[model samples]
Target: MSKIFEVPLYPYQRCADQDQATPVRHKVVVVGAGPVGLALAIDLAMQDVPVVVIDENDKVSWGSRAICFAKRPLEILDRLGCGDPMVDKGVVWNLGKVYFDERQVFGFNLLPEEGHKRPAFINLQQYYMEQYLVDRVRQLQAEGKPIELRGGNKVVEVTQDDERAELTISTPDGPYRVQADFAIACDGAASPIRTMMGLDFVGRVFEDNFLIADVVMEAKFPTERWFWFDPPFNRGQSALLHKQPDNVWRIDFQLGWDIDRAEELKPENIDRRLKAMLGDDISYELEWSSIYTFQCRRMDKFHQGRVIFAGDAAHQVSPFGARGANSGLQDTDNLAWKLKLVIDGKAPVTLLDSYDAERVHGADENILNSSRSTDFITPKSEISRIFRDAVLDLSERYEATRPMVNSGRLSVPCTYDGSPLNGDDCALMPARTRPGSPMVDAPVPGGWLLDRTGFGFQLMTIDENAPEALDVDGIEVKRLALTTPGDADGYLKQRYLGDANSAVYLVRPDQHVAARWDHYDEAAVKAALLKAIGR
Candidate 1:
């Protein structure tokens, strides 16, 4: 098939003929060139691993979906060396205001503390994010790295055995086959890979449809997030206004399930509502608009043989808390390192199973949290609505409940508690922070802290009984004392030890604590490390 679009061909495609006989293969094959897929490709390539990324789209879509970027994802991008560019271009927001009957019921700050390495969230269009990742991937490919981007190529079939995955991709020319050590499906929620594998995507699909519009407005609006419940212009409807780059704003209107999808999205209908909501004096130009039905679903399993699922393919949550893309990117961040470990022979193949287990748990939790927020925002029954309204009224009198009223639940970092990689004792304790179970940030000597830094096995020990040095080849051991007496014990009190004592904590690259011992035994620590890393 001849090229029908004006999009430029990826550099890898330019020399297709010369390498036709070589039979393209890579350490990993990533399907779909969305933000998550591209990010994973670049990250693995940065680690000196070969990656080949394929996408059906010739160019990035112009639609403005997924405009919110969360803190965890930004941290992942920072590891890839692209976080600063994104943070520079996007608007950082911390405060969110919730309204009931046009009255401000409560307000909360997203970034509770400012001096941290990353912010709470950023506002940027999905298209721009994809472009940024694509650009970086291309740059890495140009440097003679093992990163390749193939556009207008779609995966038609996948066959995976215990060792490697074979993919039959349909390119513009015709169908071709490629082999890789592993396959990652970053395709969207309606992933054909997941369906082809006969995996069950079980969850609820809400009846209400949401209308999203990105408009260029001249009116002055606060940089903070604004939400309206039961507004005068649209009764029984909730509207959200979020600031975006270039004076553009993202607006969402809850159109009940009964309305016709086509009619509700018409320019006339949207213009009428905007006029009523903002008054006649406000002027704005519509940039893009679309209507969508939200769903909360997760695949029965994140892996089938050597083929793995990441991002939306593994799970999908409602956009209420902006968990959709955030969760997907986090999946990539978790899976990339594990795959590298297995390919490099640093760990056993069993380590890959932990990726599926840990990420699936994260996806399930995100679905539950986002679903609960959606239920509170759009109650189905009259009784539920009354209860919600009463709660909002009660919150006005009680200052302690204001945070809950503003946002149902804060987007907390996730943890892998019951995984086989985690020790029995490690799974029994709770986190110090609300979502603190994932990784502990405790004080150490010389103003340097011990945390999960890269994709590999890690062990942090402060016990004097622990071995003075580590003998493991691929493991990193840090021995440091907490500078502040109360700080270290306060951080790990609930999670590891009930009392302040010298202890050793084994952590995975994904930031999950694997094992902890109050008094370190060299043999026991070695066994835990081998087990956690699947050596």
Candidate 2:
């Protein structure tokens, strides 16, 4: 995994900017070509926005770093034109079993419903996800979309003004400069751009470290997440097991706060831990091993002047919920459309503030959940540990106590309950599909509902037909009309229409329900549309 992924996926090439006497200007310049940055660039390019992505290294991530991608992120990737390949090359799972001291406590089904297009989660190597994104970037470039991936082009320095941001890039030849109307930092947790900007990133830090080992072996474990709290193997501490592609399994062993960082990562020590968990009969080769410590934290403001942050750069959560990359993808989904509308002058510049408002709400939600999960997983005191174990015990025998258990509180899509962009809502409508919620996927007449709802502001009518289109103050909104006859599965009605026989919904470009009504009305739609775009 290391050697193959280390090979440059986007090797450096000299650009015209290097020869130019002055810095060349671009619409958007993205830093750090990780999954988040690449996804953002692909999104902007798909919208015909010129975006250049620069990274210090021209390679994918070395290890299977963020393997559990939830359904919401997969949906976001679908919109970016690369979801199919990711699912095709990944391991899918929905059911997860929790264990307490070798006893099966409880199990969960993340997506028990039938109509969703994506699975509850997919376990693909982070490198593979990044490769798919890079491939998408190349395909867009070949299609003549305004996107560029410049590997080995390091952003050495960045300075922003009210109008634009100027970045100095260090390339193989020398240093060159590029000016951008918007600069987005997608660098990892230790964001260099954040440091350079001198922004304060505040939150709780964890001293405890976990040993991650990706091993290859043929095993018969079910395609399910298995989490153990004080199993006989790794007795006092906790352990986790997940299956990835290529017969690879990810194992995590909680190493307490005080430990020798170097000695624990040694091959012999890692092998010993693996043997203790999985008996010696199962022969496995350690593919990759590393020690990681995570904390719950985020930037005070995702958008600071002309510069913005997304993904790990903007917020970081203890990986238990798989929120880091997943939330980052949502950040791009939320921001890209607003940027497009603002840049085209269709929406006021103030619309960008909603990005901060909405995503900050999202970040805070993730941080809160993540903090609770961390405390539950790694108890701070002996009394806390006793209470946790007792809860696990009760959960195994009684269904009522199962909800009290928190095995990393796996990631779920964020719903902006009080977003400023949110408009009208109907008390009769299903609360799940209310304003500021991601549209629940359902099977339609042609294909999936999400697939039918393309990337743009759309008016969705269920159990009733809407006009072919609506022009709300020069904003073009297409329509997707589905009927009761087409709702053969009843999911469309159950998920969206609720008790209402007919409904009309105004969907934002990101597929979030902006405003929904019992029936379509021009005046109401116009006001909601204008409010949604910060007019």
Candidate 3:
């Protein structure tokens, strides 16, 4: 086996320095500077780790791509020092309205006041998000950080051994070879690195194609999300209306599998659909439009030796639940901390394997959830449509079943149950909040309450009676006084727990709970930390 650490760059050399004749080598080389790749670069650079991110595109694409941003992703961007600007420019939506035909069936307030904090969702275009990331990368570069963004450069080949991975790239100047301790592929669904390595991207592709159009309209629509079932334009079709930042609306229409992609993408067809959906009296201009076939697939493995995969390279989900980009960001969040530990020599090589295990788990869960949501929204057969319509119709009478009928659970954060990072005895309990869990609002002492700060790891210990007994290095621990009526009762009820003030919750960097203990014990805290960091 090859050694784990190696110095690929020379002592007197600089990386991709425009004036240097010698090729540049970095500590890590990330292929594809999309959102996921850019995020990974920013996080690593903030930790003083050297990274080179290469993208084939000359600039960010301002297409009608991803527009919905979840709360978790917003928090991740905030930690990278870009979230405030993003939130400032983007719109925050808490309610989503679901419609059947022309009537509204149910409306849900996503950010219901559980204990504290706003809803877990936001709306922002992919292009704007990328622009913000690019600005941050440039700022870091100006500050002499060891992170580089090489535009108009494509990775042609990747060869990895045990210690390092070498990338051969085709740039404007000529072909060049760059070596790094690790290579991360964030190169979308058609990842060249993943194909070159012969990894399996396993899942089924849907038959229906979707037409997404971004337009600036004159009419005022409600800020809430609107999903129309069985819209009139195309019978048995579904349409989605979402408000963008500047009076722009994102509309998606489900086109049957038989339609020709090239002909249907013409300006006439797009304009016709828009007119039918938003009346001819409304004045609007088309900004961007595209037709794409959705897929529900994930790479069998996220890692192969020194080369790893993130974002669409590892998984692809239907756009119904907006899981594709959100899950990609989650992948970066999980891998960033682990890579930091390994680069700082604070952990072993075996710790890196957990990235594959943990991220793959998230990717699979995202795929499953997205696929299920897509099936419900766009039923394939007549029988499925009939059953779905029946449920929507029946939901009108059954007031108690409205929540389940309009299941928005897809937007919920994913959890890791079977990973070696979780507690061994966590399965024995029936509590709703457990180790390796996603963070949710809960009550605490002094009526102050306890909620995730949307930053790094948070350790909440309810044992205010004995706060001195539990302490851990490199981890932030908060002691909450478990007193008062709302303190213990509200916390337990919010987390759906019958009992109160019995445990400590350890949350990960991504706002997911890592481990929980019923009693304040040092051994349990240490084990939870070790399992959480994959020690």
TM-score of every candidate: 0.88, 0.98, 0.87
lDDT of 2 by residue, 2-73 (tens): 576767899999988899999998889999899899999999999999899999999998888899999999
What lDDT score belongs to each candidate, Candidate 1 first?
A: 0.74, 0.90, 0.73
lDDT of 1 by residue, 1-535 (tens): 0121235535236336234754466689899888889888988998788888888876765667888888778877776767877899899988888887778887778877423556788998887787788778877878887887887787888887777888888766777788888889988878988777777688999888888988888768878888877878779878888998988889888888888878888899999988888888888989889988878888887877788888888888778788888887788877887888788887778888888888888888988887887788888899988887888877767887665553435465677667667662432334442111455444333331423354555565543345444756665654433322544445434434545455666656655566776666777777777777766
True lDDT of residue 317, candidate 1 = 79
Task: Give the top-scoring candidate (lDDT).
Answer: 2
Error (Å) of candidate 2 at residue 497 is: 1.0
lDDT of 3 by residue, 103-196 (tens): 7887778776665433467788777788789889888989988787777677888887888898888766767787788899999989988888
Instruction: Please tell me which predicted candidate would have the highest TM-score against the true structure.
Output: 2
Off by over 4 Å in 2: 1-3
Error of 2 at 215 (Å): 0.8
Ranking by TM-score: 2, 1, 3
Ranking by lDDT: 2, 1, 3
For candidate 1, give the lDDT.
0.74
| C-alpha root-mean-square deviation, candidate 2 | 1.0
| RMSD (Å) of each candidate, 1 decimal | 4.2, 1.0, 6.6
Worst 10 residues of 1 by lDDT: 427-436
